[model samples]
Target: MIGLCLGLAGVVWAQLPVSSFTLAWDHTVEKIRWEEDYRLTETGLVLEEARVRGNGAGMEIPEDARLEKGSWHYRRPIPPLQPLSLGRTPQAGDYQLCVEGDCHALSHWVGAPDINEPAIQLWTCTRGGDAQ
Candidate 1:
């Protein structure tokens, strides 16, 4: 029994430098979609450059950042989740980890449609920049 206990202890001690949920995220949503409710589970976010995805659109955005989707123009805020350990499994709510602040869309082309509606899209660090 003692030997088994020591083995377990050794295993735990072997895995060092493990961090807890240190990263959290936040977001503000301004969209017109029906699923007003969403979760944060996909972290690799980017700003401006957005492409169409399955059910809805997906963008690489930062933590606590806001983005617009669909056409309803519904507005809401998205909160970040706790940081998942290196070996831990992440859930749906664990994906919203990114930098904070506004992520604006690219400037319109010359003589383009004038929506006048500014939508802050989601984004993440592309070059491992600051996370504040």
Candidate 2:
């Protein structure tokens, strides 16, 4: 039926666009709690810059970008790209937070663990239009 066809078209339209992914740190090893914010790029419509707040230190993502401090609170202006990543080694304590966006299907790891080692959660993604 036309109704089914139209519904499918709208679903495709709302899907995420092409995106870039990168990782950054606070120049520290252990992160107490980290929040990384991503925003839209001007032309590329891709994920360009990411801001990470961890261990009292903050940084703009891409590792080679820049360092800034104070506040990991979520704000407007979704980062460019479809996905981005922030890096940190979790402390021995417990912390809870969100990684922004619809990135849930993405995986997490620390230092790219060996196949045999237990996977450490260091990265994540919001649902990619299919989390449900």
Candidate 3:
């Protein structure tokens, strides 16, 4: 099955069995909620949608953004990403990766981040006997 590979540094540590997932987190500076939906494709990871609950510094609402259910939603026409990087910090809290209707902390896949390794990398991968 196609899923996501979670890695630290350059080594893959864990693989999640999900074709699509929603990543939700609170802005470090704004303390507002932000969510992004992504789907795994043969080419790479495709960003499907993005939403922000109350914008602040660095969270600019796009001209095409629509306010719905107290959040600004919009989509960007960007090419597929080979790998996606996310910053990790205790102060910012854990990143919630939701698949289907369930959500889990990203640490659940790869464990806590080391002080020296403050970032997590996610990419499309196929899972069988091993993640590739």
Candidate 4:
């Protein structure tokens, strides 16, 4: 009975709508390329870009900095996932870590169109003059 209860709880938690989600892509050459969060709402999508400042050999982007004004757009919404891997790539692409909800990481893009939507389409960044 305890095992069944835990399984049901897991299922409920998985179904709960995620308040917000983040996606990060680390580029050593650029120190930071793409690291941002997208919040879901009844209206639409809200995008917040990471504001990083140099801190010795490391970096720091404060929570206040993340609260800086971000843009919002309307797009086809996707279901919330609990640390799920959205997509995968065979070889290393421009991004080191392509993350989604709850630290779900995707390394490469095999060109599979499973999670390819307008929301992900607009949430892109340019590195060294090249679009990723």
* TM-score quality measure for candidate 2: 0.24
Off by over 4 Å in 4: 1-16, 28-33, 53-101, 107-132
Residue-pair clashes per prediction, in order, are 25, 20, 0, 2
Global local distance difference test of model 4: 0.32
Q: Estimate each model's TM-score.
A: 0.15, 0.24, 0.91, 0.32
- The digit string of per-residue lDDT tens for model 2 on 23-69 reads 33324444543444333333222333445554333433343444556
Off by over 4 Å in 1: 1-70, 80-128
What would the per-residue lDDT of candidate 1 be over residues 1-132, giving only the tens digit for each residue? 000000011122111111111122222232211222222223521122222211223433334433455322223333432221211112211222222322211121111112342211222211222111
Residue-level lDDT tens digits of model 3 in 12-98:
788877889999988888889999999988778899999999867999899999999999999999998878888886666789899
Stretches of candidate 2 above 4 Å error?
1-28, 44-105, 108-132
- Best-performing candidate as measured by TM-score: 3
- Among all windows of 10 consecutive residues in model 2, the one with the lowest summed lDDT is 1-10
lDDT of 4 by residue, 7-103 (tens): 1112211111344555565444445444555554433335544433232234444434423244222222354322223332323233322234345
- Candidate 2: lDDT over CA atoms? 0.30
Could you give me the TM-score of model 3 versus the true structure? 0.91
Q: Tell me the alpha-carbon RMSD of every candidate.
A: 18.8, 11.5, 1.9, 14.6
